[model samples]
Target: MNIAEVSKKYEISADTLRYYERIGLIPEVNRNKSGIRDYTEEDCRWVEFIKCMRSAGLPIEILIEYVTLFQQGNETIEARKDLLIEQRKQLIEKMENVKKTIERLDYKIERYEQSVVTKENELKRTDD
Candidate 1:
């Protein structure tokens, strides 16, 4: 597939895909004779993996490191596993923080609703 096709299929912009390639976030893409990117299945898989990792809030620097490790062959398997484990820990912490914030927001919203109801009831009593 071409750059545009890969961009549409992945729901990512072509510029972003180019940037990812330039930044080494994804592996190098093969270009056609005309210098247009021709994404092979392997390239597309890397794009999908990068997109998923990015959407999960993984930092670009970490991804670059992971890609570097990946390029170094299978000997870095343990190191890659360690990196993923660390990233997972960070994501879990962020999730816990988000859960707490959601609970706080819910409580505040409930309080506001109760206040509104109490004020409405008071106005009704006064009009009676």
Candidate 2:
């Protein structure tokens, strides 16, 4: 598919896709004779992987390093695994922080709800 099709399919902007390619976050896509990008299945898979990793809050530097290691062939397998493990650890930490924030918000919401109910009850007594 072309860049536009790939961008729409992946819900990513074409400029971002080009930026990824330019930044070595993903492999360069093959261009057609007219100089338009023609995204093959492998290229699309790389785009998907990059998108997923980015969505998970993985840093672009780490992803670029991972892609560099990936392109170096089989010898970097352990290095790649180690890099991903570190990223996963960081992501887990972030997830924990987000969960705590959600819990705090839930507590505050419940408190406000209870306060509203108490005020309503007091108003009913005053009305009677």
Judged by lDDT, which candidate is best? 1
Q: Top TM-score: which candidate number?
A: 2
List lDDT for all candidates, in order. Answer: 0.98, 0.97
Worst 10 residues of 2 by lDDT: 83-92
lDDT tens digits by residue: candidate 1, 13-121: 9999999999999999999999999999999999999999999999999999999999999999999999999999999999999999999999999999999999999
**Residue 122 C-alpha lDDT in model 1:** 100
Off by over 4 Å in 2: none
Put down candidate 2 lDDT per residue, 61-95, tens digits, no spaces: 99999999999999999999999999999989999
**TM-score to true structure, per model:** 0.97, 0.98
